[model samples]
Target: MFKNILLLLCMTALSTPAFAQDHAAQNADIAPDMPAKFTVNTDKFDFIRRDVMIPMRDGAKLHTVILIPKSAHNAPILLTRTPYNATLMTSKAESGTMRSVLQGYDNMPDVIADGGYIRVVQDVRGKYGSEGQYVMNRPLRGALNHTKVDHSTDTWDTIEWLVHNLPQSNEKVGIIGVSYDGYTSLTALINPHPALKVSVPMNPMVDGWMGDDWFHNGAFREEMLSYIYNQDATAKKTAIWWGNQYDNYDLFLNSISAGALGKERGMEQIGFFRQLLAHPAYDSWWQQQAMDHVLADLPLKVPTLLVHSLWDQEDNYGAIALYYALKQKQADQPNLWLAMGPWNHGGEIKEASTLGPIKLPSDTGLYFRKKILEPFLAHYLKDDAVALPQRVSAYRSGSDDWETREALPARDCTTDCTTLHLTAKYQLAMNGSAETSGSVSYLSDPAHPVPYVQRPVITRGAANSAWDNWLSTDQRNAASRPDVATFTSPVLTQPVSLDGQPLVHLTATTSGTDGDFVVKLIDVYPDEVPEQRELGGYQLMVSSDILRGRYRKSFEHPEAIPANQAQLYQFRLPIMNHTFLPGHRIMVQVQSSWFPLYDRNPQTYVSSIFTAPPEAYKPATITIDTAKSWLTVHTADVATP
Candidate 1:
């Protein structure tokens, strides 16, 4: 009966006049009349924009964008090669002014406009508008990468083209960028082109395994999965990881292990994700890609400026590590310089007068651009430009001032390091020993790991997310946790300043076969603030780091930690030039897990934490021997302005 009714309806619809006309219209052939291309006239603009594809050593052609000022003649070329879209970076706003068009990442608009530089931005090979295969932080042409081409070769070819093709260029080029673009700038230093005069690598990704975007001291940064999925899954970054809920902490906590979450999210399709799972430990694969180690052996020809941020949430280790690595070989080479600012990742380009609740005396980003960056670039890329005086420009927090010195640590605190001992009574001491040789124990459950930030944790890159400045946030959230052990010092009688990396020496024991340890050094504010009332009693994190127990002895090798046995673990935290002002107290908190930010340790002995099963996650008792543990902080008597 249904088939008969359907046949009768179809026959009645076929007989209708409207249905017949619609069918005839669908069958009719319409001529295609769209234009093949469109043109953009920029004659009235202050700068002439050109889009071209520059060929690499291989057959790949990278998309390049060049912006020349209206009166540009013999101007220095400032190049920035990035995986990010060049078109977006160059054309940020639709305006007649050149500064309006180039106002995004890596382009200091005021400085660029004032310096009269021939600006150039390009898409790295295999990214947007570039033709080639994409590899995540592609290793140099070596054992890890069997291919003959790499970022260095591509940068060299790009510089060669820029010098020959542009008549307005002065034949001198300076490369500057932040993060991944900074990494590309470092690549150019390996075998620099003759035209390349200066290189500014600001917050670069030097080592992913040690302390960078990917991992920190053998702990996998699981939150970076979203970045890898979005970046490597597609050429134009169309693949975005959207969480079903608002809180990323709950989303990650419910997803079991990082490996399981990746599988559920279809991250198995990304080559970098597969590589990450395969190499859980620091092996040749990661060691070969470490730029600091790679550049240590190479000759330093270009005048390179290493820019670092005190509160950089990403790539914080790159600039500092590379600075030290290059300093080891800087006896005769005086071309290397270092600049440390009070900003977050890429915050040097933005208005850095304030970071989170902390306020600076001035716009530190603008100060750096005008005083340090502009002068350095002009001296190298232009003719008869005055040379910069200082080799190191470090911004000292707490005092809210900038210091120019000949070398870092300004003054060496190696032999005069201040040692803060942890006591059994939960106090930090400068001279006294432990009142009792007792130990502090806490339950570390994989099921209820401590959140890295406050509740309702949002994913990185999300709108209004605090991922960029979480390091500078208040640490009272973690200190209040029962699972975390806190040690506090009395209010400072005088100002105490730290000039170098703080060394963490811990003697700990875990009931489970394996575990992890996170140590944070924080600055506690006074109970009353006259200026910013909300900042009263604020606890700001100064320096912190984590160490995986399995790789405590060797980063390259992994072993099961002996259960219920005391073992010593030592590692250096990030460098800091902060001061504990008068009336401020210093606090240190120790915990087992920094979850969702880093993958849960499971607390059980597993060959690879990435592939650990649910059964491996067991609650374990962690003990800290207060008598044996102490934090070694380098103290410097910085001369305040």
Candidate 2:
């Protein structure tokens, strides 16, 4: 038996190598023939697409895609630098026509295709196909940023390359974008290149802490967490926001606190999240990055067209703020222009005939592109193009028409403004002051905060999310809440037009050491609308804002509120250009919390609200002095452009 076993083992081992050799020979014989490279034929296409790696001043290569019309020669270049993937922005469809591929965000297909302009879009450093490290709105080369290169230097390098490399293009270049890309367009203005003749920064992000994406006053905009996670977690934004719950209200409520929620979602791994955790106040880190402050000292050399949206949800504070900042310093410069439109953030690219239930007289988006943007660009970039005539073009909401002016607000708002007083009877009066004796009080529970919009509060950017037109939502939902204090003005017999920022002054007291106050300026429609039945009694929000009580003393240094004592809190809402028609009524609603949109204030003071314990959040009684609260709005006579 032993001899038989030894013979079997030897036979198996000898046959194994013979079988392996036979298999290897078979694999070599059947090897597939495939080409390593192939060429794409473009004779049938009307546009030429060139993808190149643009070298920056710091040696980092940014991915850029340029689209040139087949019949083009010496055509001016229109550029957009964005952190959002340039490949996605420039490639919308698989078609031979250039217009078909450029029909997405931040693009006007008709203007680009018909006007014969070469279109270019690039990925900023460290985003998408670009090579470098990523930083959220990287500060300029100074104390904050230890690096030698910034967005300004990168833009200068890019423009230098484009003019020299592109033989089918004119030397003139124009930069334009919305939001983050808009922010990049603004950066190009700092020590701009000779080729950069025009810039259009539409709804740019000027400041994160003051009123932009991250925070408003001192309250953290909690809804923007998903954006930070998705944008910063990976280079390709591969990290998905795993929000298991359908309603964001429940998702946020169940988490107890923003800090706790962030931890549970693994936000500790992101750099921006760590920075957000480190700085919860308006410190030097945030102040130095504000574009309004940074551009105040720089010269306004290029012809810049500042486009502001009346209902811009993400960046309502940016373009307007930067415009005013630059205007204060360079008021005499004719190159600086302003155009205020009736749309949401980046809404100029879409069909802007109406927003929600409110309808406009014309397609304002089309009018803007043909009449305002095209002319503005042509005059600067094209040699034979006619010059633009208007310096300021603003759209009036209630009138549903465009108005041109030499200056904004049409008049000096400080001297021509009207003050509306809030009386103890819950009436908005033009003459009588607020009641000196009594006050309005309500119970504010953190467990049951006021919703920013009607619930089933879906996550932002989700399918059918209310983020697009939440600014135009009916105020009745908030006014009906028990915690919200409502004050209404008598129906206007004649039209009253507001053309500037609305200043809010509230004298209030809270039972807790820390709290939040939300003030909303609404335009309440008449009880009946025969033409549009669904619009009847629609309480539209014209302008609104919020301020954390801790920052009442100072934005830099927060202090606890003296409980049960009347303290005056004053802040400015976003700018507005609306007319309260004869039958419309003006209403102001004040509340303690605007939830999930902004994180819930602990109501009790702690060193840092971001790290506040769950027990710190408690119910409190809030009181508003009726006689002391008043709203001041700038009025203008309605006129057509």
Which candidate leads in lDDT?
Answer: 1
Candidate 1 weakest ten by summed lDDT: 407-416
Residue-wise C-alpha lDDT for candidate 1, range 269-328, written one tens digit per residue: 999999999998899999989999999889889999999998888888988888888777
Per-residue accuracy of model 2 over 446-501 as CA lDDT, tens digit each: 99988888998888899978988889988888888889988898888888888788
- List TM-score per model, in order: 0.94, 0.94
Candidate 2 residue pairs that clash: 434-627, 435-627
Q: Model 2 reaches what TM-score against the true structure? A: 0.94
Off by over 4 Å in 2: 1-40, 410-412, 431-437, 639-641
CA lDDT of each candidate?
0.89, 0.88
What is the clash tally of candidate 2?
2
Error of 1 at 227 (Å): 0.4
lDDT of 1: 0.89
Q: In model 1, which regions exceed 4 Å deviation?
A: 1-36, 410-413, 433-436
